[model samples]
Target: MMGGELKRMDLTMCTTTHDPAPLSVEECERARLARDPAYDGRFFTCVQTTGIYCRPICPARPPKPENVTYCTTAAAAELSGYRPCLRCRPETAPFSPAWNGSQTTVARALRLIEDGALDGPGASVDGLADRLGVGARQLSRLFRKHAGATPLQVARTVRVQRAKRLLDDTDLSMTEIADQAGFGSLRRFNTVFAEVYHRPPSDYRNRKRKGRGSPTGHRALNPEPLRV
Candidate 1:
């Protein structure tokens, strides 16, 4: 196939295919109740009492049917003002298929964002675009289409997930944790952590025992700049 034709074929393959109708709330509720990992990135479940949203694979008990709202994307849940659940690390769920198999600029941007491409030292959307050999604006448009989030928003999601992992698994100081988590500053880290997780990092860590499981078996925390 010609390059242009090949590109078109690739794009078509990556596009989401589904019935025009929405998945019934009942079906999503059943998926949530089952804690189905396969549905993790494909949908989000919101709890009425906590006002927090989680991926379908969240280990928390399923909420009553009357108390749940299903979302098609994490960005949709965030736009609706729902905070993410720390326990499930929804942001770490597998990337949308739109991102995984598509050959468009947006798909590449989504992959880079998952790798924390827009943050840490020497990282920017322009840098990402350069690496992908596309203009930054084109990259942004692709991200918005497939991810329902700007490039920056996608990057923030990745950072939040990294922060959550550090918060849950380590006793590292906040500043150290922030640095390791790819935040530019302790203040910025705190702000985003609270915004996404609905609590300060320290507060979340302090809620449970300092050490829940084995430490030595895990790698020691490293502050080196992360590529993803």
Candidate 2:
């Protein structure tokens, strides 16, 4: 998935400063139109019309050039008010090579977040920053500069995406899905899922099942399962 190739490129090539540089509109457009694998994860294309972001290699029909905008990172796209594309599933896209090199602190923080550092007991911004040997304020600033989202927002996205995967790929109940996906409580899970996807988690799961065959060979449960 070009993840390996991205790692091999010089990290310095990804950004010249602490903040990532914006992708060239012309080049990003070409890559989006071509569905170029080389450019996948290098930048995300946010469709203004749909309010969804996708990887360059997404198989969905490309939006008109005027309706497309590019973000240096998926986090940036999400922060810019775009949801991950249902067709392309931006979460499954390869990690941006730049993430590996340009900013090590942000990268390390992201790895920890993905591992659920922020999901349970003792998971505070101050705690995470201390683990990384930096102050909370500095860590927050760095996250905003590099990832385009606060550490909490990034962590929430990770949790929400995990919950989505479980919903799509398994018959897990909402409570089970919430726990397995690192949401401490169903109430919090439902709130965050609604904020991100503009629907209840159960609604999303039902819609996905109707559009694509159930992955686990069983009918999806009703939205009633989501009630606390």
Candidate 3:
């Protein structure tokens, strides 16, 4: 676990940003053993033996010191193939403000992806990377490090989440919802929705009209970046 070393990227608009170094192993270990709520989201404990990651305040029995590694963010731990602890619910842990070099780049890329940069025909990660002034491979590494998921995964989650919101809040037809959510076609929308939520998109359509009409513009998209 190379904790906070960020390689330089070709992003010109933003100069190098320094993030605080991650908590030391000894500090994290002490916090975990004490189960200190004050230290909750500052760092996550990765137990190699169980392949699980937990908040410092996890009530579960601690793993041996040799088996544990510390990650600054849930994304980092998840990127390293550790699953979040059910007891600690690390996903719900308060976010840390610190971000290493490529993390800012990932954030920009995420916004672009969310705004349909990769939604339409001819859009690709290479194109998106070019917009961010980085290479496709480098962007992917940054995405994995900062988001714990691929860019496409993030886009797909955004689309699905937006589709769900459209389903619940609007009276849009399935086809319209599919298009608005960036799905190329209704069939494709149904397939992915079913795979993610284990239910078809139609099943989630809002039934109650209540004298409300669909908004002329699309609703705000705020998808929680899921680990797809």
| Overall lDDT per candidate, in order of appearance | 0.69, 0.77, 0.76
| Model 3, TM vs. native | 0.48
lDDT of 2 by residue, 107-225 (tens): 89999999998988767889999999988999998998899999998888899889989998999999999999998899999998898888899988887765554667665455233
Per-model TM values vs. the true structure: 0.46, 0.49, 0.48
Candidate 2, 174: how far from true, in Å? 0.4
lDDT by residue (28-131, candidate 3, tens digit) is: 67888999987777777888788888989999988888777776667877888888898978887554333244677898999999899989788899999999
Give the clashing pairs for model 1: 115-228
Q: In candidate 1, what are the lDDT values of residues 61-168, reduced to their tens digit?
A: 777776666667667667776788988866555665433543466676777777677878789888988888878887777666677887788788788888889877
Tell me the spans in candidate 3 whose CA falls farther than 4 Å from its real position: 1-100, 206-228
> Highest TM-score, which number?
2
Candidate 2, clashing residue pairs? none
Residue 202 lDDT in candidate 3: 68
**After TM-score superposition, what is the CA distance of residue 219 in candidate 3 from its true location, in Å?**
28
- The C-alpha stretches of model 2 lying farther than 4 A from their native spots are 1-102, 213-228
Q: Which sections of candidate 1 miss by over 4 Å?
A: 1-104, 210-228
